[model samples]
Target: MRQTWRWFGPADLASIDDVVQAGAEGIVTALHHIPNGTVWSPKEIAKRQQLVRVRKDGSPSGIEWDVIESLPVSEDIKKQKGAWRELIANYKESLRNVAAAGLEMVCYNFMPVLDWTRTDLRWGLPNGGSCMRFDINDFAAFEIHILKRPGALEAFTPAVVEEAARRFAALDDAGQKQLARNVTMGLPGSTESMTLEDVRAHLAEYGNISADRLRQHFIDFLSEIVPVAEEVGVRLGCHPDDPPFPLLGLPRIMSTASDYQAILDAVDSPANGMTLCSGSLGARPDNDLPAMMRQFGPKVHFLHLRNVKRDSDAISGSFFEAEHLGGDTDMVALIAAILTEEARRKREGRADWEIPMRPDHGQDILDDLTRRAQPGYPTIGRLKGLAELRGIMTALGHREFGLQ
Candidate 1:
């Protein structure tokens, strides 16, 4: 696998020096300055790539912009309502521009309500720094108590609702505000943020769309755009729902293996594939990460590697970001499977077959505190993750080659 880091462009607090130091040879970024629903000109893509290339510290030896983490999907496109034709047209144009810059894969998501939910952004770890995580009880409190969105309690069981009420009542005003901000505010790559009023307005946009309706809209949007992606040699890898469930009175369709299958079957093209985020899908016990790797191996063009410790108590459980080798996901076996696929591609003389993988969400630790980096994207944590994964890969590769 070719290791890459997700950089939020030049203005990001984590500089190109930080990415190179973390040992990533490739950069996963986007033209975030370009507004949603607007076309990205080739000039803009080249300019951004140049900035990263020049700012990198290692004699121009590190970090080339190779993949776009996203091209924001317009709400009009998501709703699949009026003006969708124009939105789809703009998306296709953007894909062509990205491809013209020689980028191969574009990672995107079609989740309706939220991109990824975290009850706590700086959820503390015993090891020192923090990691991003979602807690059902904390989220429940946000839905049923804080936001007080009607019918929000219906998504949870009776027991969960009662617990949520208790949790809500227990929190001080400041704590409740933090919970609301944590749930509703958009993080990086989410494209939009919401105030309490903005959230209600956003919910109104999805008034009649159920899960099925949302799924159909995604399918339709992909049907129009994937063909263009194929023409431009850009693989469109859709990221999974973060918690793998619905939240905030919105419908979530791409949260399971079957959901992935439905997407590939709907588009039925190599251009339409999965990003295979372990942290996102691994939050749910039912998602067998290894089995998913085997099943989707042929179609996976991108990867997000991070592990979570699921708690037995369910409601009270908090996910601590574990070391790449320490988590419940069995990442060693997962990486071995991916390498096996890469070996098969090599034997067949296929170029560009090694999937581009990245250590998904990292802990905010050490020197990263002095920098303005995004939470969970701290330099030291991901550098540690990449080092661990690299060591595992090296041992496996040497053993396969009979090297002592």
Candidate 2:
């Protein structure tokens, strides 16, 4: 795996120096300063790439921008009815520009309304850092009690609805405001912004579109672009739906193995692939991470590795970010599967098989707390995660290949 870090460009609190110190040789970033639906000019892409590659000794080692975390799909694109042709065409042009600038992997998601959802941004960990997590109850409270969109109550049980009402009632005005922001505020890479009205409007766009409809929309979008991606030598990896389920009455299409298989079958191109996020799929017990890795290894172009602890009894279980080797998903088996795939690629002489992997969703710890880092993207916690994963991969390599 080629290790990389997600940097939010120059304005990010985590500077390029910080990324180098964290031990990644590659950068995963987007042209965030550019608005959605606009083409990222090759000049802007080169500027960002130059900034990321400058070494501490002031030499340019060409630390490349290997992936675009996302090129946001405009609201019109999602609806597939209004101004979508223009947005899709612009998106393809952006892909060409990025490829022209020498980046290959482009990661994006097609979730209808929201991206990743976290009920708490500061879930305390035993090891002194705080991790972001989702609480089912908190999400329910947001949907049923706060956002209060029509038919939101149908998504939860009666008990959950009652509990959500109680939780909503307990919040004073400030607390309620914070909860709204925490739930609705678009995280990095997601383009959707939410006021209560905006959330309603977004959901309404998906009104008649069932899960299959949304999936078709994604397939249509990809069908138009994957050929272009292949022509430009840019691999487009679609990130799975976080939490792996429907929320707020919106249909979630890319939350399971079958969903991914459907996507690959629809596009049937090597450029169309999966991002394979462990934290997203790990939330569902039925999603065997190791098995999925084996099945999708050939098509996975990127990886976001983090783990979650799910509880059957608790609707809102506490999830503290664990060391890479400490999570419920067997890190050993997962890495072994990835390594096996890499070995296969090597044997086949495929140059692009070493997928770019990053430690996703790190805890906010140490000096990171003092500085204003993006939520779940604190530097030290990710450094710890990267260090741990590196050690595990090393040990696994030795055990599997008889290296010292």
Candidate 3:
């Protein structure tokens, strides 16, 4: 595994120099300033490449953009409506531009309406730290009272719905508004922000889109884009749905191993690959992270290595971000499996044997608590995570494979 760090452009609180000081050899980023369905021009790609490589004072950071954390998939393409066809064409052209710039991997997600959801951006932990959390009751409160989405009551279990009512009633106007903002916040610095009305309208658009239908749309998307990715020698990785389950009565098609396997079979190309987000998949108890990695080893193009502490045995129950080695995932076993896959790729003479992985999310600890970094992305927290993961990789490399 090649250790990488996610940088949200120059506006990111974590600077490129900060990434270097954290010991990351590669940077994962995207051209977020560009609107969705628009082309990422070669000039813009080069500009970003220069930004990643050169620091503010014209000194080399000695790091290049290794992989695009995402090349945003437009809502039009996900719905297969409006200007979806044109968006797909634009996506293909963006792939060409990225590949032409020498970037080989691009990660994107197909989750509709929201990219990821959390009820609390600063949920407290036992150790006096804070992390992002998804409380089912709070989420239900949002669904029932805040957004007031139809059929919200029937979506959750009886206990959850009842608890949600209590929680909703306890909140004042300010509390309710905060919860709504937390639920609706899209990726930081993107144009996907939504109002209550916007969310309802989006839900209305998906009224006829079932899981099967959405899955087909994803397949149609891959069928059109994967070949172009292959031609450009770029790999396209589909990030798993966060929380990996249905939310607000919307369909979740890419949340399970079987779902990913179906996707692998759909386009059946090297360019069509999995992002293998351990945190997202690990939220579900049924998802065995090590086994999934071993099975999907060949198709994994990138990795988001984070861990989550689920509140219950239920797959869609609440979960909070845990320390790198402290969550439900067995980080050692997963890293070993990744090493094994890399060895296999090397033996087969694959040029892209090293998978680019970044420490996905971390709890706000120490200075991070006051720094007010991006919600899930705190400087000291992620640096700690990256160091721990690197230690594990180093130990496993020497112990399991005897590679120094």
Candidate 4:
């Protein structure tokens, strides 16, 4: 595996120097300054490449941009309405530009409205550390009271609904506002700034959309974009839905192993692949992480290796971020499965045998608490995760006979 780190642009709290000091070999980032549904010009791509490679004093940073965390698929593309064709053309042109710039892998998601959601960004852990969490009742409170979306009550059980009502009754005005902000903060520049009116209008547009309709839209999206990806020799990976469940009356199509297999089989191309985020998929207890990796390893183009400790046995139970090797998923077996895939690719003489991976999220501990970094992306925390994952990769490579 080639180690990588996700970096927001120049204004990010975690600097490029921090990435280098942490021992990452590659960068996983996007052109976030550009608007969604716009084409990425080669000039813009080159400018980002220069930023990643060159230091402030014109010295070398000694790392290259390896994978695009996303080239976003627009809302118009997801619903297949309102100038979707133009957005599709723009997406294809972006892929062409990415390839022309010598980058090969791109990651994107098909989740509607929100990129991800969590009720609490500062869930306190027992060890006095802090991590992100998704408490079911807290989310229900947001739906029933904060956003006040119609038909939201029908999605949960009677017990959950009653609990949500109680929770919502306890919140003061400031608490209610903070909860709304936390849920909408998933996409950095996109929905993070949406007002209550903006959120209500956004959910109303999807009233007529169902799981079947949204899925077909995703297939229609792939049928058009995957061909261009194959032609340009770029690999496109679809990230799974975070929390792996339906929320805010929205349909979730990529929450399970079956969901992924269905999409891969529908498109039937190497360019159509999976991002293989362990933390997101692990949110569902039914998803056997190692087994899924073994079955779908050939189609996985990129990796986000983190862990989550679920609060209950139920698939939709609350969960909080865990240490790299401390969560419900089997880190040892998962790494072994990935090595098996890499060995097979090497035997077939494939160029991209070593899949790029990053330590996805980490718990806030030590100096991280005071740094006040991005919610899940503290400097010291991720360094700890990368160190643990690197140790596992090294041990696995040395123990396996054919692994290098």
Clashes of each: 0, 0, 0, 0
Pick by lDDT: 1 or 3, better one: 3
Every candidate's CA RMSD: 2.4, 2.1, 1.2, 1.4
Candidate 3 lDDT score relative to the true structure: 0.91
Off by over 4 Å in 2: 55-58, 189-192, 313-321, 399-404
Give the candidates in order of lDDT, highest first: 3, 4, 2, 1
Q: Candidate 4, overall lDDT?
A: 0.89
TM-scores, in order shown? 0.93, 0.95, 0.98, 0.97
- Give the Cα lDDT of each candidate: 0.80, 0.82, 0.91, 0.89
Worst 10 residues of 4 by lDDT: 186-195
- Model 2 lDDT, full chain set: 0.82
Higher TM-score: candidate 2 or 4? Answer: 4
TM-score of 3: 0.98
**Best candidate, lDDT:** 3
Better of 3 and 4 by lDDT: 3
How far off is model 1, as Cα RMSD? 2.4
Cα lDDT for residue 157, candidate 2:
78
Candidate 3 lDDT, tens digit per residue, 112-145?
9998888899999899999999999999999998
